[model samples]
Target chain A: MRALLVVGGHELRSRLRDGTAPLIALVAPIMLATLFGLALGGDDDPPLKATIGVVDLDGGEFPASVQREALNTDELKGVLTFRQYPDEAAARGAVDGGEAGAALVFPAGFSEGVGAGRGGQVSVMESPESPLAGVVARSMVDRISALVEARTLAVRASLEAGVPADRVQVFVEENGAAGPALSLVGDPVAGGRVDLAVHYGAGMAVMFAFFVVGTTARSLLTERQNGTLDRMRAAPVPLWTALVGKSAVGFGLALVSMCATWLSSVLIFGASWGDPLGVFPLLLAHVFAATAIVMLVASRAKTDAQADGYTLGVAFVFAFLGGSIVPVYNLPEWLRGVSLITPNGWVSAGLSELAGTGAGPSAVLGPIAVVTGIGVVAGALALLGFRKGRFA
Target chain B: MTPALVCEGLVKRYGDKTVVDRVGFHIDEGEAYGLLGPNGAGKTTTISMLVGLLRPDEGSVRVGGIDVDEDPVAAKRLIGYVPQEIALYPELTARENLRYFGRLYGLPRRELTSRIGEVLDLVGLAGRGDDKVDTYSGGMKRRTNIAVALLHRPRLLILDEPTVGVDPQSRVAILDRVEALVGDGMSLLYTSHYMEEVERVCTRVGIIDRGRVVADGTKRELVAELGGTDRVELTLDGDVTAAADKLRVVEGVSEAVVTGSSSIRLLVAGGRHLLPALLAAVGDAGAVTGVEVVEPDLEAAFLHLTGSTLRD
Candidate 1:
């Protein structure tokens, strides 16, 4: 343990002393988080900025009423601004020229036909190039069409039956009773701040853990090249003990870096981690797994350059597949399934669930088991890759 | 006295090339042994195999009575090594580096602290241990590297080109320190391509070429076995083909090799007897501007045994 600490201290000091390590490891992650967080938005998501224009060609008896109803709908109040143009050509031109992203056209007799128990087309025009705008335009049109029909139908039905406006309002209110309840797990954490912190903390730790492995592997290569391996071999310490000492240094350094990052997150950034007991097992499992992967990579690479490239490629791929950048929930189902096979994904998922909710600690168990299993498998491969009595 | 290190039939091969082929020797306690070789001669490879960094294809190594392959940890504990290249962490202070290497060998804290001071003084870097290694000169860095290796006070010390790139003064200082250590009874295996360095400091020398031991013994013994031949080169102002023929007939002269120009070199048993006759012969043909009689040394012995120039 003392030897391990000694090596760990050296590794830590080296990392702090290197200007590049701190920049990439700490500064980059924090900057990325802040930039991405702001870009995604704060609480109370406003409707995204999307340009929508309308060409109402319908000059009917109930046109004014239709316009008033369109203006009052939920979709139009804040989500969209409907601009009435003289013709579809002008609106289409505006959309095509990029002045607007989408255009809507209400055909002639559209409101009148709806009043007479008929329907008319509310054409949603979009530049196929802007697929997102097309989607937005279609959604807005659907809302407007529903609102116009509901108002027209209610007015026609009441006038034919000679019902007064006040009575009709009372009847509609009475019938619009309870709706279907939304189906989901349970109440989420009131604020997103805790979830965000745990997600980034676990992810950043996993990412930098790979760097620790890469750096240690490079140092091993350097030792071998410099003939120190042979020197050490002539010493009293066994080869296996030296290897253990080296690997333990990497493990301890990575652990300290992760712990410091965690502390910083909790104190400075207001990050709340999961249960301490739960976190340790999870982090321990991942650390070994990451170390094992690094060792295996180092063994395969004949040069420092090859090791560096391989570590980077594997680390990033695993981090991505593991859902470090985006939540597994937001990822495509196929990708989420892929993430389960990687230790990083399991760690992120396990940590987020454990730290985010007081009651959902059980949600972490599956990921924990998977991560530990990966560690075992990777550790076996790493040990196998390490040739015995070969350092000198 | 027991040998500080011994290896019998030590062999190591990489792929199709036998890098260190069936090489074996021993360094008695308190002896400074030098392994001299050219590039690709497996000097470094042999040292690495002995130190337990590489597994040999065949044979065994014993350092201070410990079997390296059978029990590497025990074997390693009894040895200290300094590599050809600088391997200390530049960002760390010399003291920190010494402490690190000491702790790596699992030295006790108090012992390590004291030994750090002693080794620093031994390498002549006593008060400069607090400075970062990068801040030190090349010679200073080399000294610290040696200090790191000496932290454990191993019975056998191995240095691979410890003075490869340092200034002449630094090289002398290093040689002096190495001699002092050997005098104090530590066995050493020093490898270098510098013939004079091996000739000056090594009690016994092994000349390795093409991954095999070509020659081994004391300097005078090997030189004697290779035969007492001196090289006498004579530079004349004009063509000396006729003069070379006349010098080759001298009693002590074995053969005379004439250059394409007005110079000739004679391989003779003793230059003291052959020099006057050879110089008179060169003077007979043309004006003799330069005459030199060089005795047998490691370089001459190397050329005779390997049939190639040592510099080549």
Candidate 2:
């Protein structure tokens, strides 16, 4: 145990003493996070806003309740900003010219059809790129449909009792506005500010943590090529101990780096990482898994140069596939399934769950188990190969 | 008495090339043995195999009577190896490097500290021990490297090209320190391509070429076997081959060869004594311009046996 500590201390001091090593390991990740945060605006949740143009070409007046019900609706009031469009061409032009995100068109026969007890449908045009445009277009169509359906139902009731359709429609339109008020249920994901910055920060942490493994593996190769490893073997200590000592140091540094990333997210970007106790241990476990992977790679490399090339190629590929560089949901199902094999994917998934709503202890258990297991297996493989001839 | 290090018929192959052929040698306790060879002559390979860094294809290595193959840890405990390259971490201080290597040798904390200090003093770097190894001169780094090997105070020390690229002053200091260690009853197996260094510091020298020992003995004995004397050469304008044949009939000349188109070289018991007859021989054949007598040293003996210059 003491020997391991001494060896680890030496490794740590060596890393800290080097100028570029610490800068890349510690400072680079944080800087990247801040840059991405300012650019993307926090999390994946977007706050959408749009200006919608409305055109009513109907000449005949509709029932007072129809207009009052349409204007006083709760669903459309908070979601969209309405502007009156004088004609269909004008509304369409407004949508195309970027003056409005979407256009609502009520045809000339819309009021007459509702007044005669026959309901009509409205058409909404929207831009392809705007989330707000989609939302506004759908809401306007649904609200107009609901208003027409109520008048139709009232006329049908009167006709069943042998009353005239015109008289029934006229009578129902007057009372339509008196129907029960529209109310929406409470929002489940409300007040959870969707900041793109948090996602960027989490992604950066996982990528950098994996990078540390690659860097350490390269260092291991260097030690071997330079004869330091052989000199160490000449000592009385078992070679396995030396290998384990190096992996432990790598694990510790990775864990610290992970913590610094999370802290920066909190202190600089205003990210609320939920509970600290849960995240810290999970991060440490994930770091252990990363360390094992590093050892496995370092053991296979015959020289420092080989290790550098192989580690960089492998680490970045795994990182990108696992959603460190891109989100998993945006990828195809097959690609998402492929990410399951990667520890970094599991780590990012685990971090998102910890900070996401509806997360529990079970959410973190899978990543912890996967990463820890990989670490154990990788550590053993490295140790075994190390004893054979890798270090020699 | 058991030898400190012994290898019987050691064979190592890298791919199709046999690097260390069935070579057998031993260094008795407290004896200084040198493995002499030119570049790429497999001297490093032999030392690596003995140090347990490379396993021999077919050989047994016993360090302090412990088989390296069967019990490497036990054998390694008795062996300290300083490789051709300086292995200490450059960013670490000299003292830190020593302490790290000491811990690797499983020295107890108390013993590790004391031994680190002792070895530092022994290598003549006690005052600069606290300075980073990278800041030290090439010689200081070499001294620190040797100190690493000495920390465990093992029974056998194997050094491979220890002073290959160092300055002359550092080379001399390193040789002096190595001599001092061997005199204090430590067995040493030193490998170098420098023939003079072998002649100066080694008690016994083994000349290895093409993965095999071509000759092995004390300097004087090997020189004597190759004929103990100087060589005289005469450059003549005419009939050099017939002049070479006539020189062989001389009383003191042991061997004669037409080394060049116009030159005849003769190995004689006494070059000065044979010079008169060689000049007379050149006169009997043709006009002679230059007649020179040079002493035969290890360099000459190596050239005679290998049919190649020592530098090449």
Candidate 3:
């Protein structure tokens, strides 16, 4: 244990003295997180407003009411804006010419058909080039259609019950301006907001945590090349002790980097990580896995350049597949499953759960277990390689 | 007394090639044993096995009477190794490197602190211990390297070409420090291809060639094994043929030959004792302007054993 501590301490001190380690560990993660956060729209920044082109060809109250709801509704205030076109051709032109992301056109007699309790037809024209705004416009149109159908049902029920049609209309009008009769409430999953800063903060942190692999492998190869390994072998310390010591240094650096990124995100960007108890253990497991991976790479490489190349290649592949570069939730279901096979995937899931739902230890336990398993397996392989003199 | 280090039938092979053949040697207590060989003579390989860095395919190494393979940690505690390369963290201060190694050897913090100071002073880097090793000169780095090994105060110090790239002044300083350690009764196994350095620092020498020890003994013993002969050269201003014939009849002269029509070379069993008579004969036959007597050294012994110069 003493030998391990001594060797680990020395390795940490040496790396700390090196300028490149800190640059990769701290600076790069912070920069990437900030860049991604800004690109995704920061919490304090105004949300992007997408323009929806509207063409109410119905020339009636219902179609005009839909347009009015999209234009003057408080919920869609900053989320959407409207450009009224005189005709379907003009609306389609606006969408195709990039004047708006999407265009909503109501066919003639659409409002009369809906008022007579028959289904109305409306066309939503969307540009493939600007999908986000078009998707938002389509959702708004769906809500309006649902409201019109509900009003038709209400009128039909009142007429069947022998209530006066004028009295029913008055009742409908009183509540129609009050918004949707039925509302769906979305509960916070784990009592936390799904902040972009938090998602990107964890992502960039995990991505840069793998950068520690480069530093770790390079240091190992350098020690071998410089004959320090031979020197250490001649010392009283066992080979396993030295290996553990070196691995501990890498693990410690990655852990500190990840924690710093989390803290900085919270302090600098107002990002919340949700529950320290869960986050700390998850970070530990992630760093351990990272360190083991580095050891495995270093053990197989005979030179510094070889180690660097191997580490770089592995880090990039893991980063990409594990959703460090891209969110796994954004990937296809099968791809997300493949991502779960990587340590980074587990880390991403764990961090996302913690940040999104204020998930406690129980929520992150499975991922932590898998990450720790990876560490143990990779560490065993690395030690085997070391004993075989592959590292030398 | 038991030897400080022992290796029996040490054989190390890499696939089909044997890097260190059944080579064996021992360094007794208080003796500085030199392992002399040309480059690629397996000197480093042999020392590596002795220090437990490399395991021999078939052999046994004991340090302070403890088996190195069976109990490497204990064996390593008794040995201080200074590699041919400067095995140090250049970014770390000298004191930091020393303390690190000291702790690796399981030295207590208090003792390690004192030992660091002692080693720094011993290596003449006491005042510059705080400087980063990268900023140090080659000599200083070498000294720090040695200092790290000395931190544990092991029973034996294995220095593998410690002065390979050092300047002459630093070499002298290193040699002086090594001599002092030996004087203080610290056993040493100094490996070098430089014959002069081995002769100057080692009490006994082993000449290795092609992974085998060709000769091993005291410097005098090894030299005496080569028929105890010495060579004398006379640079004459006049005819050297006469000097050659006259020198051939000297009491101790074994063979005399003339070369280049200006000098005569003589081989004698005791060239120093017969130098005066040989000189007189040369002067009588020809005007002897210059005379040089070559005594048998480690180089000559190495040449006699391996049929090649140590440098080659």
Candidate 4:
């Protein structure tokens, strides 16, 4: 144990002093996340945000309800910034003048007509310049229409079930003032909008982490080429102690890289990876998988140069296929299935899940098992390679 | 007395090929032994097995009476190994590298601190011990590696071609430092293809070839295996063939051949002394302009035994 610590401490200090390790491990991933984040969105806000105009003239409970829910919803804060107009003409003017991406106007008698089980009048004004915002507003209006119809049907059913007409009207006016369809309308993800940036931060992190922590394993071949490995082997300590010492450095650097990237994403780009308890297991598992894979790849190389080539090749291929540089969903359907085989894919999937709504510790249970399994299998294969006489 | 290191019938084989076959040697305490061989002659493999870096297919190695297989850590404690290349970490300073290895060697903390300084001074790198190894010259790197090997003060110092890629000045310094260590009662097992280095530093030399030790003895003893024959060359002004025929009849001349139009070569006993008599015999055939006689050395013995040069 003393020998292992001594060697590990030395390896850590040496790799830190080398300059490239720290740069690749700590800085590269954060920089990639920032650049990709900026390209996706104009800033750290959602990738697609636009201003929408709302004009209400209905003087009824249903139109008031739709106006309140659509204008000030926090879940849609990233995708929709709401503005108010005095009239439908003014709302059209805002859309035509490009002051707003889209607009909504509620006709008078909208609530009474709908409460009588008759249809209400509503209109969506859209602009060619901001089609996404227009689609988002239209989708919210459709959900509101559905909510009013469902409430009208319930009121009629209540009357038929012998509830007094006066009481039914009070119930309809009170509960119907605030619609429950806002969650589906406010959240772009639940409305079929994909946010690839959620995965980009941790995705780039794990990919670059492979290169950073992998160098320590590749140093085994470098040491062998330069004869330092033989010197250690000829010493009075167990040779495997040297390997353990190097691995401890890899694992430590990987941990630091992961935390720094996660923190950078949160602090810089406003990314929220939900519940630390849910994400911690995936972080540790990803680190182990990265280290074990590099060690296994390096052990199969005949020389240090060969080890470097193999490490880089594997890092890049996994990055592309696993949605680090490009989203896995952007690939062909068949390729998305292939992504399931990569460690980065599993890590990004877990991070994306945690970044979404209502995520708990159970969000990453599957990813944790898969990533940890990869580490165990790869670590065993590396040990077998060492046993086959690549120890020095 | 117990030798510092001993091994017999050491063999190492890869799948279908034996790289070292039944190679055996011993180095006594305070004595210097050289294992001389060309490249791929099994010296490194044999040394690896002896140092516990490799396991022998069919032999046992004991260092200071401790079997290496049974207790490798104990056996390795008695060996300071200097491989052919400088093995110190380039990113680390000389003192840092030494301290790391010294700690692994199980030296006490305070003792390791002091020993690192001593070894650096011994290798003449004390002034630059705090600089990163990559910033130093190649020779300085080699010296620092030597310092690392000597830090633990092992019973046997095994150096495998310590001067192969060294500058001329550092090569001389390394050889001098090694000789000084041996003079201070250190047992040494040095491997190299350089004949002069072995002839100068080692009392006994083992010549290995094609995975076998063809001969092992003192330099003179190996040279005497040639049966005291010497090579003689004579330069004649005229009639080289006739001169060769006349010299062939001389009392000590074993054989003579006309090598050139004006030169005749001879194999003879006591070549240095037989020069004058050969000149008298060649006098009738031609006027001898120059004469040369060659004596026996390790190179000649190697050529005689293995039929290949040291550089081969």
The TM-scores of all predictions, comma-separated, are: 0.70, 0.72, 0.72, 0.73
lDDT of each: 0.72, 0.74, 0.79, 0.80
Off by over 4 Å in 4: A41-197, A387-389, B131-139, B167-169, B231-292
> Candidate 1: where are CA atoms >4 Å away?
A19-31, A38-202, A218-235, A240-243, A256-280, A301-307, A328-337, A348-363, A384-392, B232-291
Candidates' chain B TM-scores in the order shown: 0.85, 0.83, 0.82, 0.82
By lDDT rank, best first, the candidates go: 4, 3, 2, 1
Candidate 2: residue A184 lDDT (0-100): 24
lDDT of 2 by residue, B1-312 (tens): 899988999999868989899987899999999887778888888887787777799989999999988888899999989989999998789988988888877888899888888998998998999999999988889889989999889899988888877899999999999999998999999888777787788888788888898887777777877665676777889998888778878887766777688987667777886677677865668788888877886755665556544455
**Considering only chain A, what is the TM-score of each predicted structure?**
0.60, 0.66, 0.70, 0.66
Model 3, B203-248: lDDT tens per residue? 9988889999988899999988868688666788876777777887
Q: At residue A227, what lDDT does model 4 achieve?
A: 82
Candidate 2 residue spans exceeding 4 A from truth: A19-22, A38-195, A267-282, A296-315, A331-338, A369-389, B109-114, B220-310
Q: Can you give the lDDT of residue B271 in candidate 2? A: 81
Q: Which is the leading candidate under TM-score?
A: 4
Clashes of each: 14, 5, 1, 0
For residue A7, give model 3's deviation from the true position in Å: 2.5
Ranking by TM-score: 4, 3, 2, 1
Worst 10 residues of 4 chain A by lDDT: A185-194
A1-392 per-residue lDDT for model 2 (tens digits): 76667667766676677653466567887888778877764533332345677787774454233334444655445444667788989988888887787877778887777656687767888865444554545554665577567766776776787877657655665766333233323321121222456667777777777677666676667778778877876666655555666666666667777778778888887885555665776677777877777777777878888877777776788778887776664456699888878887787677666675436666688788887887789878877776565473
Q: DockQ for candidate 1, please give it.
A: 0.36
TM-score result, candidate 1 = 0.70
Which pairs of residues collide in model 4? none
